[model samples]
Target: MINRKILARVAGVGAAATVAMGLFSTGAANADTFVPLPGGEIVKTLSDGTVVTVRLVGESANINPSLGSTPVHRNAWVSGSAQVELSGTGADSGGRIFPGYTVGCQVNIAGGGTSGGVDGGVAWEDGSPSIGASGGGDLSLGPGQAQSFYILDLEQADDFGSETHKKRNVFSGSNGSVTWADSTIGLSGCGGYAQARAFVSVEVETESVVTWITLYGQPFSIG
Candidate 1:
């Protein structure tokens, strides 16, 4: 004796509302998607049958927008550490067969109505036990557009030498961290999506033998 038509209409409305809520929740979760980057590793053998392995691990980034700026600027603080290990006969040779190694990091920015890039790295001399860092970048603004690039910070250890050599040559073990911060700004008529990337490199050297390897992380977005 009930109104069958009215009951069916109410049920359909309830089902539609449930589906709408589910779609909204999915969109919200996707907005917060931040994927963790994968690390890369490489291994090389010296002339004397010495095996050297380099790895880039614990890589991450933090992106932020500048405050109170007419043309908004985006900055990223990228952090990670490089590890070097020697095995086989030359593993324990220290400065005898293995001189030392160099570790470095660089950030590349492209798109978002801007163009430019920056990079930096450090060298460790086992014989001198010395450490040095070098960095540089380039940037130019487009018509009716304003952009800027900067290498904000770099941090590394300075313990690659001993009393005698003051800067010991390369050794077999871990060499702390090589971190850097870079930024890019876009203003006025500049309004588009920009992309950024982080990369690491390692170099191994001896008196007569030398080799180099590099790895890059997945690219991220900055708007």
Candidate 2:
């Protein structure tokens, strides 16, 4: 979560039950598995001599796989950090960072998933992908489907001075980062296997150009 208050937010009703089962169960059937992922790195130099680097670090997931009592449910706690750096003449300018994950149900999300975009397809208002899913990770999907959700729900005042929630963070001065731990991912309604992949999309703005760069993390099994 971008906001400290939002960290470790509940994935769904199943999270509590899953945690309890992991505590009391002794057999491998209910044991939790911890996976350490090799976070990735990407660098791109904008034609204007602006160098941008994005890295996904400290990535991991603790999966309960199943509730054991239900074949349609899976639970996991995920953690990671998204870091960005900018250099060259435009480094001083600011940009927005949006970090989230795409969870698929028997759908191959590699290289950006199916035609329109992952499950439910990518939402683009003006030819740019906008990850604006506000609903939490408690998802329902069928085979060959997928969905995306952001890890941040920042609370702040809008132009009218009323409370509003923002999914991205604004940063400046050549560097910015967002980290989250124990973020819950609860799934339901897919009788088959499921998988999830992390994504960090950053909007970089220099004097002459505004570009979006997205980096995808390795996908992992939910069961």
Candidate 3:
């Protein structure tokens, strides 16, 4: 017969059984404990087969220079063609955002992109056929501030492009207070085409917020 005392020690319950027996005794076998490995980040795969990677690209204050007065604000954004490939058995909807994945984006402007009179009244707004030109007020950078935000719609097509190629206007996860600058900033026209061909738009989306800070003085306001 197997030694009961040796089994208890190997089983890791020898001490418990020893107290009951008044002498060293083997303990019953206990289930092995399982420990999970660390370091695997969970990523959501969307229905459109798009993978949403969450990360901080930049901050609003770092991107926008116009917010030097009240708060240092900036916008985080992502732009480029998207890549889609079929791995398993799944249907293609032409234009559909895969569920589980999220595309969050934000964008701010330089001093030149601000409102009228404040920054010489010159406004740098981008416009596209689908989403159109977005104004500074959308970001609520305040009177002298200006910024924009964006994200992939994944579902609807706002810009003019091949449905088979996945053409859609980017949307903002933020409220009406935040929005994209315009298609004109990067895209050529309302037409989402590159080199006059069906270009594949594979790009990543970004998101950000405004960080409040103090602004400096001007030549007139100081002296």
Candidate 4:
């Protein structure tokens, strides 16, 4: 009778251990809930009556947790592709008009606070290690500000044509992957949450007219 009671207790402990392991597995699966960002598309009509459509597709990010910490640091890799299509009566006829424009995409990371004891972190290019920049200045966010970094830029100047009629050129490109790393004083403060976003810009030019349009993508967390 003593031996049988001991065996029963051991079996009960084993069953409880199995249930605990199963719960831990379920929690871990739920923690990795970051999904792909939704792509964006927009159409705009320029002053010259030209209609341009811009699409941002295949957007994704890989976020890694802090790598231990004195100054806590986190990393992320972002990638996506963009395309521009031109169609309108005002498009230059028989000439390469689209190639004269400039197309680009930028990523923005923002978080933290200043006076409220919140710590706004700084982000830099992953491999190149350059601090982000915008409007010809260093990019850093404090409280409500955001810093923008270029993902890709393409110029269509070499594709110009001599045709006197309406010219249309379609521009499309991909930003394979750009890595970004963020550093904070420590992760224990009020400004712990960080987000990443993407945007596309286009500059359209004619001999006498110029127009600009920009589209923004949804924001995703990096933590």
Which parts of model 1 are misplaced by more than 4 Å? 1-35, 66-72, 93-191
In terms of lDDT, the best-performing candidate is: 2
**2 versus 3: better TM-score goes to:** 2
How do the residues 144-168 of candidate 3 rate in per-residue lDDT, one tens digit apiece?
A: 2222222323233346754432223
Worst 10 residues of 4 by lDDT: 12-21
Q: Local distance difference test, per candidate?
A: 0.31, 0.66, 0.18, 0.34
Judging by TM-score, tell me the better candidate of 2 and 4. 2
lDDT of 2 by residue, 147-175 (tens): 77888888899899999988777776778
* lDDT for position 200 in model 2: 74
Query: For residue 203, what is the lDDT in candidate 4?
Result: 48
Top model number, TM-score: 2
| Model 1 C-alpha lDDT versus the unseen true structure | 0.31
TM-score of each: 0.44, 0.81, 0.21, 0.48
RMSD to the true structure for each prediction, in A, is 21.3, 9.7, 27.6, 21.6
Query: lDDT rank, highest first?
Result: 2, 4, 1, 3
